[model samples]
Target: MASFGIIGSKGRMGQALASAVEEAGHTLAGGVDAGELPGPLALQADVLIDFSAPAALEANLKVARVAGVPILIGTTGLDDTNFAAIKDAAKAIPVLQTGNTSLGVTLLSALVKQAAERLGDDWDIEVLEMHHRHKVDAPSGTAKLLGEAAARGRGVYLEEKMESGRHGQTGARKSGDIGFATLRGGSVAGDHSVIFAGEQERLTLSHSAENRTIFARGAVRGAEWLIGKPQGRYTMEDVLDL
Candidate 1:
């Protein structure tokens, strides 16, 4: 069984991950959260799973690298600079990072890509996502991911054509632009939809997480899949073979 260490031990997702790891017949080496990074994390487990905040990610990743342990990072809210650090760390250890961990979400991304490609840029792509009230990022990482998939399908850079929702009489939607809409409410686990709006037809691809355990399970699965892999960055799409 895989020996696992969780980086965000006290948070909701962290607790869920710990439980899932144990339930999956894996050993929980230890956990680190906030100011509590546990002692010698690298010696305690074969792999590390990070569901912590952006501030804690780099430190935990460094710990993983020094120990030669692979890491599966699930935290969101990291900007390009922080992401660059992750890429740097991947030089020595296998790292798997994902915006969302639900296997269904990765499959939805694939389907969205196919739809965007088949339907062509003539179809406007719009991403709608909703998460729990505590989620910190607007447009959620999942929203940006869906937009990226659409952008990739259209063979364009995401920044050049993606429109993250507009307000105040935004006029008509721009052509070939991928739009994003976000909503936060109650304790929603997650919900994402990709709408391809074209003349006389509309195609919507969506995934809803009824329980956060889906993410926890995926993270554990990813950690198990990452053991002993060569140094590189990977995604859940790789995990699920999408």
Candidate 2:
């Protein structure tokens, strides 16, 4: 079993990952939070799991590179600069990043891609997501991921086709455009649904997260899979072979 180190040690996801590591019969090398230095923990781990904030990504990746350990990043709300950093880090060490680490979500992404391809652009595609009120990001990273999948199937780029946060006087839904709606409240772990609205019939593919354990378990599994991988960027689909 591999020894796993957590980069967001004190957070909810980090604590859940700790439990999952033990449940998977793996060793918890150690963990470090925002203020704590991660270099020591990175050196102690066979693999590293990062569920920390976006701002911490560069530092965590630096430590992972120094330690020469593979890392799985589950943090969301990342922008272009963060992605560029991840790409740079992947040149030196294995780096797997995803908005959600749940196995169900991985499979759901594949299904959404297939459906979007078969349904054609005639069907208006809209992605809806809801998270706990404490969640800071809107439309969620998962929603963006699903949108990308839909765009891929339609042979379009998500950046150009995505419509988010429709307000008053917005024109009618445009065909071939992927729309997104976000909801925040309660203690919802997570919920995502992709709606394909057609003339007569409609189809929806969705997944609900009951707790953080699923994400934690998936992160551990991903870490195990990434242990000896070559320097490169990867995704949950690679870990799950979806």
Candidate 3:
């Protein structure tokens, strides 16, 4: 059994991960809260699971690299700089990063990719997501994940084709660009949908998260799968072999 170290020990996801680790018959190496250092815990772990804030990602990767341990990052709201840091860290240690860790979401991404591939640019793509009121970021990571999948199918990058928060005299929606709409209210765990609009019809793929445990359980499963891997970046798709 792997010793899994949690980087956000006091949060809801952290608590759920602790329970998940035990349920999976794995050992908990230790954990760190927002202000605590994870270096010592990393040294003791076979793998590290991070659900902490985006700002702490670089430091967490450094400690994981120093300890020569693999890490699975489920933290969202990351910027380009954070991605650059992750890419660098992957050169030295195995790193698995994803917006949503739920296995169902992974499958949803694959389905979205396949649909986008089969339906061409003629069918416009749009993504919608809703989360708890406390979530600070617009367009939840899962929406981006699905958008990226769609973009990949269309042989493009999400960064270049993404459109969000359009207001005022936005004359017309671009032909092939992917758009996103975000909703915030109540205590929603998570909800995401991707719509493909054609001439007179629409096809939508969606996933709803009922609890944080789904993410935690999936993360623990992915973290266990990350053990003894070569230095490289990975995703939930790799862990699920989708």
Candidate 4:
């Protein structure tokens, strides 16, 4: 079995990842939190799983690259530069980043793409997501990913034309615009829905996380799967073989 190391080992998601790694019968290489990357990081395992904060992403990735360890990164709200750094690092070592690690969410993306294709542009597409209040990021990375799926279905770039929400004086919903709405409340682990709206009927695809461990389990699974792949940037889709 491949060995595993977990960054952000003290947080709920980090603890969950550690537990999942053990439950999967993999050796625990080591665990580190918001400090200098430990020397042991280089020796601990075949893969490192980073579920840390956005502020620490650069350092975490630096450690991974310096250690020559392939990694699975689960942090969200990465800006364009951060994502660019990840893609650049993948040229030397395998690196994976995902908004949601749940296998179901990956499948949900595929289904949303198919739905968007079949429904055509006349049907409006919208993404609604909710997460714990403590979670940063307004629209949630999953919402953007879902919106991308819809955008791909409709053959448009989400960055150029997507709408987040509407207020007073807003006219009718624009055709070909994928809308996004966000809610932050309670301790919701994570929830996302992709809705296709038409005049009278609508279709929705949704997933709700009951606990944080679901993400941890999937992250560990992703680390295990990534360890043997050729050096490249990847997503949960690759991990799930979707």
Q: Model 2: which residue pairs collide?
A: none
Pick the winner on TM-score between candidates 1 and 4: 1
Instruction: Say which prediction, candidate 2 or candidate 4, comes out ahead on TM-score.
Output: 2
- Please give each candidate's TM-score: 0.97, 0.98, 0.98, 0.95
- Tens-digit per-residue lDDT, 139-227, candidate 3: 88889999999999999999999999799999899999999999999999999999999999999999999999999999998998899
| Candidate 1 deviant stretches above 4 angstroms | none
Best of the two (3, 4) by lDDT: 3
- Model 1 poorest 10 in a row by lDDT: 33-42
Give all candidate RMSDs, comma-separated. Answer: 1.1, 0.7, 0.8, 1.4
The local lDDT score (0 to 100) that residue 147 gets in candidate 2 is 95
- Tell me which residue pairs clash in candidate 3: none
| TM-score-based ranking | 2, 3, 1, 4
On residues 47-142, what C-alpha lDDT tens digit does candidate 1 reach at each position?
A: 988888898777887888888899998888889877998999999899999888888888888988888888867888889999999888888888
Q: What is the C-alpha lDDT of each candidate?
A: 0.88, 0.94, 0.94, 0.85
Tell me how candidate 1 scores on lDDT: 0.88
Q: Name the runs in model 3 displaced over 4 angstroms.
A: none
